[model samples]
Target chain A: SQCPQKWKRIFCTRCNSKRHSRDRCPSVWRVYLLKDDRPKKRKKLILPMHSIYCYNCGLKGHFGDDCDLRRSSRVPNEDGSAFSGDNLTNSLKKEYFQ
Target chain B: SKDEDANILNMDFPWTINRDHSKQKEIADWLTLEIRDFVSYISPNRKEIELRNQTIGKLRDAVQHHWPDANLHVFGSYATDLYLPGSDIDCVVNSKAGDKQSRNCLYSLASHLKKEGLAEDIEIIAKARVPIIKFVEPLSKIHVDVSFERTNGLEAAKLIRGWLDSTNGLRELVLIVKQFLQARRLNKVHTGGLGGFSIICLVYSFLHLHPRILANEINPIENLGVLLIDFFELYGKNFGYDHVALSVMNGKATYLPKSNWKELHPIKSTFQLAIQDPGDATNNISRGSFNIRDIKKAFAGAFDLLTNRCFELHRAKLKDRQGCSILGNVIKYRGKARDFRDE
Candidate 1:
């Protein structure tokens, strides 16, 4: 005497379904033969740059200690603008007292 | 045949049972005596310790005979344990002098042991990279995990133990962190159970709290041992100070009081700063890019304020009798402070 056939669950890849077995599926070979057609994306380029802030100075791109304009403290006589250190200190003190 | 079956019954496993009960009992008795004698011989003793040294010497000699210049040394549980039984002996043989010669020497020693009837149940594991023979005696039932490594010189070995000791505190910290996370059901990071990154995080957390925790005025090697002991005292249950309790008391948990939120914000910011990449301008902009250096400076400032200042403030609060018992209870529960009795 022969034994009864027992049912088993098998998964399907064509429709991403699990209702039927691969052997019972209609387009089993077709799904395996299909090729992916998505195109690859391009990569981005990077560039290097420095910030405006300088470590030497407490200001943008220059430091208070290395201020060249302040060091010279006087303009050439094209317009006759001359400012001495003592005059600047005297003006600052007068402003403070006021 | 019955007597033979009785004899077989006395052997360790793969035995046959027979009808001769008295013979079987005699075999059993004899087997027990043999096992007892072996156990006694294997127990920790001056003689056994000397024998271990002798075995190590013999191994070194065998290595040398095979390859004229091989350096051997012992390490691991055997060296650390005061009363160790059934602990495997670990040895490393350096074959940096000549690889091929060392390999040949290891093989010759194995062959020699076999010829001398000492290799009956001996496992001879050979390695090709550094070339060494790992000889394991089956009757002894003590494994010797041998490695043949390239010599990195004497200074490297001196640094090795110190480095190992220094991380001992970090290991305990990792365990406490793991326990805290587990208690709160937030232990997702260590699904594989306390990996290298997890350990690094724990160490970083402790170091983040006190950057000078690892600093010592003593020699580096001695400092590592001291740091490890300090770490153990901080987190070890035996020392009574539980890191989890301290972490909870310090308001690291989800149920923090409204008053603690200000103090906790900086800690959260430090974590946020750590995860942000400075190279990605888009990401930085999205996260509101503050200067990376400023974030680090802020973290250092906050770490000092949160750890040292907060600890001082909290300790001062303990002067009140109610708060004192809370601190005392925490210390007592963790086993940090011993109970006192009036005489």
Candidate 2:
């Protein structure tokens, strides 16, 4: 008797990875706080590959929600065909999915 | 002079989205470092760990001296190494007697604990679903909860230990999430909040299914900040709670549609959070957590606050970024600090 092998299918449109869905992509931007403690010299960190740009303002540093600039026409239309930043934060991305 | 220079340097925020090409990675590194510091801050020290061991030993001696057939074992967060300061130690007794949860046995243990001067503020709850005794160890001042013949917790502790060994950031994430929920009073299952087991499952599943993690593209240690945000986003805003359920069975994390889970057929609420119990296939671990709405809302709020704070801090002048904390808004621990445990 042999065990059955199940193939799990996952795809992330955000980072275009076949290993995971859009919800888990690393292209999504996140910011954290800095501690006030010591440690004079900090070591450099290895970064992931991220090329995602903000959908609203077409910026690279931030996402749609954090985009301070006026909403641009680059937003996805009703047909879901235009520039799709699938990595947008949930509050902004949920309606896009619906 | 060096210290002053370092202080001044620290006051200036080094990474910004506009300035740094790998701003996301920088943020992840910062978050990972902060998570490590927070876990180290809240973890039990040598003195605390020694005290707990002594407490457990004294408890085992007292229980066995009174009932030669009974043996006590530690379980729950204390056993899983996921407990915060002032958290209660969960214990379970194994006895040959079938009626250990009976009122007579409960009162007997309470009496023995009282007589031995090992316990104070002893309260026996015989009418609850699982009859047990709760008390504060007089000398150590540590709260303890003991149940009779309930080995499920002990088993769960072993499972969590295995998870801790296998998962890279399980302990750090669990501790952070635990503190976050505790701060908001959303960690208690009795009050309809998520319990320790369910919380662990949620984090475990999130880590296993993360795109970068799945593809071996990111080191969990270097990318905890973005991972943490993704966790909140998945649960807070993206997860289809009304139609989907969570499962972490067999080390494979997945989201199962409600209709696909045959074990959850007995559960009536279609909108409830359903997490399949790894120990028992037929069980839903999160059935007791009825406050899914509040939990989801809190997670969403955390996502907003973290992203907003990041955006503001990034846009702020370097001088203005001084003394700001990103995790402080979500997790606030003002209690007595503990010495960092030697690895």
Candidate 3:
């Protein structure tokens, strides 16, 4: 066979770059095509978000009483706006829904 | 000769000359002149209208001649103003020497007054009250209380003044609380109602609220002193001064008027209890009077509630059997119930 003069560089299928071979590439370039696939191992991440308690609903793991969905559900809605009833009825409904 | 002349010049003639017993006008004139001359050195503003001060000055001068290092201080109601028209004048005479020397100094001073004819009708009670000599001068019928303690031991005097000052707030609160209770007839606790305990309850409640209202809102030291004075004053006004004196003397629980008592819950107790006795009987003592125990209990209760601590109960005999403890069985029961519910 005749000797070849030059070889073509391999492109990364993940990052779409020609910088290095697949094994030498950064982990950030790795992508999982499906949820079942193992996620790439990288440095530990610390997010800025934090959880707060909702006063109105008397529940943990939420921010702001006004933003509590549970409180919205407790509000009266006689005009069929969303939810409405006496305290007993609402409590019963909450029990049923919960 | 000039020094002798100066000494003679300084010797006031009115005080030097003695008047006959039959010459009342002359004695009175001479005494008045002597007082005017003595007061001449003092500023007009500093001059007290009290003849007691004049007598004290004369005594002070006489004592100075014997014990030049002696220092005099004034104390008691006269220093503050728990004084009535007949309040006794209290003075303390302190010396660098010990008690024996101080006593000798006092004796010599008393004798000097006698030689000057100032002590003829004056009753010099050497062994009268502790910490004070009871001297009743015939010149003014004013009882002068004198003491011979070291000047260094002024802590008691300072504490008295401090306590009096601290009570001003307590006094104002007492007046307001008394008026409130009286107006609402919440005081009808004694006799056939809640009895003296109701006043205790009201005072405790007031004290409980005091720290909260006073914290950061007022000066604690100053306010506390004022409150205390006010509290004592109110207590004196409502309760007879005799009751307080007896309580202090005998260490007994004093009583207050039903009109000045404040039931914890007026509406709840109104139906279950009688407001007043039909016989219109009055308490021998007033509602505002308090003993050391009462003060301790009040402070302890107030502090406990403020700090969220359990209150300690001190028991006393009541009507034969040891009465209900001061921490009240009802209050304890309610507190336990609350705790149980919380748990």
Alpha-carbon shift of residue B100 in model 1 (angstroms): 4.2
Could you give the DockQ of candidate 2? 0.05
Q: Give me the displacement of residue B262 in model 2, in angstroms.
A: 1.7
* TM-score of each prediction: 0.29, 0.74, 0.31
Better of 2 and 3 by lDDT: 2
Those runs of model 1 whose alpha carbons end farther than 4 Å from true positions after fitting are: A1-98, B1-51, B75-87, B100-106, B115-132, B138-140, B152-157, B164-343
Model 3 spans > 4 angstroms off: A1-98, B1-53, B99-106, B117-132, B138-140, B151-153, B160-343
Q: Output the chain A TM-score of model 1.
A: 0.19
**Tens digits of per-residue lDDT for model 3 on B1-343?**
2334443334322112222222212222222232222222111222233565787677677666656777666665455332323446677777766553345555766676667655544444556444344566667666776777644224434533443454323323332233323333333433322223234333432332232221222332223323332233223222122211111111111222222333322222111211221112222222333232343233333322311211111111223222212112112111100000110
DockQ of each: 0.01, 0.05, 0.01
The chain B TM-scores of all candidates, as shown, are: 0.34, 0.90, 0.36
What tens-digit string does per-residue lDDT give for candidate 2 at B69-174?
A: 8999999999998898899999998888855777898899998998999889999888999888999999999999999988899889988899888888778888
> Native-contact fraction for each model?
0.00, 0.05, 0.00
- Model 2 Cα displacement at B259 (Å)? 0.4
TM-score of the candidate numbered 3? 0.31
Better of 1 and 3 by lDDT: 3
Best candidate (score: lDDT): 2
Residue A17 lDDT in candidate 2: 70
